[model samples]
Target: MLELKEITKIIGDKIILRNFSLALAPGESVAVIGPNGAGKSTFFKLAAGLMQPTSGEILLNGEQIKKKTHLLKKRIGYLGHESFLYSALTPLENLRFYGKLYKVKNIEEKGMELLKAVGLHYFKDIPIRSFSRGMIQRLAIARVLLTEPDFLLLDEPHTGLDQEAVSLLNLLIKERQEKGIAILLISHDFEQVIQVCERVLILNKGRVVEDKSIDHQRGLMPFKNWYEAAVSGK
Candidate 1:
């Protein structure tokens, strides 16, 4: 459902991404892991059409993303490292605003459902400025779900989340995957990554050095071993 072909991104004199490529099929969940400065966020920005690659192209479905942004925006949901919430707006107001932007049907009902799902129903009328980091994160998740996107790009979505919020995040990921949403997420939480994604891609120095499928039967040990080996150049 999403494809990046031979993408290279350079900023100033430094290269951030070099000939990077990846594809996500419908209903598939992929996790990207790497050390700091591995260009994971840059890759997400390229895919989301928030920034252009110096070379290569990003496609959603069959159309090039840069050339079809307006049409593609409705089909994709992106959650970045920051919550990007309007602090002055109430949770209900925030969802209603985005829901209207996406032209979502029954926005009021849908907004309430999402607020409840993210455990923010009680705070629906409260402005986000008073919320704690985790609460804002939960409300952000609710905001992203307002459009029911077909493709999800999440960058460190687990940031500021507690164990309960993380559990809710996992459940939402599973539900979206079951509904045939294509997902690409960057995360350092190995345990949660194992629970949510079917495949893992290890990016190093702007390149995908290893792509491995999770072996659920063997558990996290195998993934840890593989990641260590890959990063250590084993």
Candidate 2:
């Protein structure tokens, strides 16, 4: 559903990504783990069509992503460092606003459904400024899922979420994965990585240093050990 072909991005003189290539298929989830200067954020932006690559190209459904930003907004669900929500608006109001932008049918019903899924139905009318960090994160997730996006680009999605909230987010991710949504994740939580992703790639210095398919039987320890070693240069 998504492809990044030999992509590279340069900002001023610093190179952020180098010859990065990836293809995501329906129902597959991939995790990217790397150190601070590893360009994971750049990779996510490029894939989401939020940033243009200095070289190479990104494609979605066989079309150049840059040319179809409207399609990108509809097909991609992105949760990034920014919440992209209104602090003064109630959760329902925020959802309704975005739902209208996405042109989702039955906006009110869909807003309530996703709010309930995120355990924020009771706070549906509460203004976002009064919420806690975890509450805001949950509402952000609800906003992302409201459109039933085809591909989810989640960057540290568990941020500020409590244990229960984390589990709830995983449950939602798993459900969507089952329904054939391709997922691309950048995260550090071992359990979240193991539970939802089928493949993990270790990126560093703008390149893929290690890429391995998850072996569910081996458990998180083995993969954790591998990740530690690969990026630690062990």
Candidate 3:
């Protein structure tokens, strides 16, 4: 459903991504693991069309995304590190605003349903500025889901989430996968990555250095060991 071909991003004298390429099939989920400054977030931005690559191409559903950014916007959902919510807006109001932006059908109904899914229905009328970090993150998830996007790009989605909230996230991702939404995520939590992703890509110094499938039978420790080894250059 999404493909990045030889994508390169350079800023002044620094290269953020070097010929990075990846393909995510419909309903498939992939996780990106890397240390700080490894370009994971940059990859997410390029995939979401928030930034353009210095070279190469990004495609969605067989169309070049750079050439059809508007259409691409309609098909992808992105969750950055920040909640990006309006401090003065309540959960309901925030969803209502974004729902309209996405031209979602039954906006009110959808907005309410999403708030409920994220456990924010009770706080629907309360201003977001008073919310806890996890609460705001939950609301952000609701905001992203309002569009029912075909491709989901998440950067550090587990940040600020408690155990229950993380479980909720896992459940949501499983549901999206069942419905054929492609997911691309950047996460430091190996457990979450193992739970939701079939494949893992390790990025270092602006390039993908390791790409491998998760062997569920091997359990968590082995995967953790592998990731540690990869990142530590073992």
Candidate 4:
């Protein structure tokens, strides 16, 4: 479980986020949609323990996550615009490094499983610098899963993925949700996102404007309507 309490972020005279708050429980997946500069990534960074919030706190379980590096590493997995991979290292080497960091028991087997799942098995020995954007994204995704954290903060995770990779990502999300993994998804692909996330949070100007359940029964119309209406209202 994760909770954000009255979170605020300010730099200079500009307020990046204003009283933003959220609570996520096991097996819950929430998708956040907002225009650029809505503080979505900032929220993810704060939740992932990448950056400390200027006000309030982010709590994992019952404890504040500030300065709790080990707990954060064990409980939260984050994938943002940055790949966070070493360009000089091969996919296998990169995975091995993370495996050591997480103290993964079966690093070899786990790395192979992940590489195959992400369609990178054949390229395991290729340095990350030689990979395409989509390939880099795939490896980054694998890296995130290596830890199998309780919560996932994925910001624009589908940015450079192809349809096949997109489907794989969706399947991964579905599998995680089924196993009680909490997910915070940020994506523009509403059709694909609705299939994985049960709820949607519409944010505007760093504040949540709408919070509602997604109706996947109707396919994409419900989300399209909701998003269009929300943006038009502003």
Candidate 5:
């Protein structure tokens, strides 16, 4: 489980996140949605331990995350909009490199299997420089999977994906949740969120203004409506 206790982040004179708190359990997937500058990405970075909150605690599996920083990294995987892949390296090589970094045993075999699962096996030997944005995203996902993380944090995961890629990603997300992985996905796609995430947290002005299940808020305006509201500072 992951827990955030009254997390508050301040940058200069602005408060990006204020007294934000939430808990995520195993076998659960959540979508963080809001308009631009809602601090959704900032929240992800905090959970992934890339940044610290000004006044709060983030705990993983009952342990204070900061105290077990190294162990926490092993249990959580994060992917942002950036591909984070070596452009000169083949897909397989990239996966292998990340697997090794994670200390995964039999990196080659595991990398191959992961690439195959993400539908990148055929292009395993092709350098990432030749891959499209969507293909590279798939490969990036594969790299994270190789670590067998207990939690996943993805920012703008569907940004450049096509319909087919979106379908595959949805399938994989369901599969991962079934495997007991807790996932936090930040995105602007409300329909996609409704399809996969059982719950959502809406951030605005660096604060979580609404936290509820999709079913609970079904009667409200559609996601696009909510997005416009947040971005436009409504």
Candidate 6:
């Protein structure tokens, strides 16, 4: 459902992404892992139509993303590292607002469902300013799901969450995958990556250094193992 052909991005004199290509089919979950400053965010921005690539092309659903930018926005859900919620707005109010923006049918019903899904139902009446970081993140997640998009882009989704929250997110990921949502996860949590992603792509210096599939029975390996292997060219 998503494809990139030799995508490259340059800022001033520095090239962030160079000749990077990736394709994700519907219903597949891929994890994108890399060291800091490896251009992972740049790649996601290019795919999400937030930033244009200096070279190459990005396609979503067989059409050029640049040409169908507005249409594609409706089909993508992006959860950034920070929870972009209005501090003064209650969780219900926030979801209701975004639901209207997305033109979601039965806005109130869907809002309630989403709030419940993210474990924010009881806090629906509390303003986000009074919420903990984890609560805000749950609201952000609810807003993302309010759109029911086909593709999801997550950047450090586990930030500021405890083990219980992380476990909930894992269940949520599995649920989304069952619904055929294509996920591109960028996270520093190697354990989450190892457990949730079927395919793993490692980035280094603007290029993909490793791309491999984990068999269904397999799980995430230690980050040190991968990092050392990368350095030693194993």
- TM-scores, one per candidate: 0.96, 0.96, 0.96, 0.93, 0.92, 0.94
Q: What does candidate 2's lDDT look like per residue over 74-165, in tens digits? A: 89999997778999999999999999988999999988888888989998888899998888988898899998899999999987789888
lDDT of 3 by residue, 1-234 (tens): 788999999988899999999989999899999999999888888888888899999887778877678788888999999988999989899888888889999989988888888888898899999999989988898888889999888888998889999999889989998999988889988888989999999999998889998887888999888888988888
Per-residue lDDT tens digits for candidate 4, residues 19-69, read: 998999999999998888888888887787777888998887878888876
Q: Candidate 4 — which pairs collide? A: none
| Candidate 1 least-lDDT 10 residues | 63-72
Which residue ranges in model 6 land beyond 4 Å of their true spot? 215-223, 231-234
Name the TM-score of candidate 2.
Answer: 0.96
RMSD of each: 1.3, 1.3, 1.2, 1.6, 2.2, 1.6
Each candidate's lDDT (Cα)? Answer: 0.88, 0.89, 0.89, 0.86, 0.84, 0.85
Ranking 1 against 6 by TM-score, winner? 1
Candidate 6 per-residue lDDT over residues 1-234, each given as its tens digit: 889999989989999988999999888999998888999999988877898899998887888877668677888888998777789999989888888877889989889988888888888898889888887887888888888989989898998988888888888878998999999899888778877888888888788888887564544455548655874467
Candidate 2 segments exceeding 4 Å error: none
Better lDDT candidate (2, 5): 2
Model 6 RMSD in angstroms: 1.6
Error of 6 at 217 (Å): 4.9
- Report the C-alpha displacement of residue 207, candidate 2, in angstroms: 0.2
Candidate 3 residues lying further than 4 Å off, grouped into runs, are none
Write model 1 residue lDDT over 16-93, tens digit each, in one string: 999998988999999999988999999988777788789998887777877677666788888998887899999999
Against the true structure, candidate 5 reaches a TM-score of 0.92
**Deviation (Å) of 192 in candidate 2:** 1.2
Model 6 poorest 10 in a row by lDDT = 215-224
Task: Give the distance in Å from residue 20's predicted Cα in candidate 5 to where it truly belongs.
Answer: 0.8
Give me the displacement of residue 31 in model 1, in angstroms. Answer: 0.2
Residue 215 shift from truth in candidate 3, angstroms? 1.0
Q: Which is better, 2 or 6, measured by lDDT?
A: 2
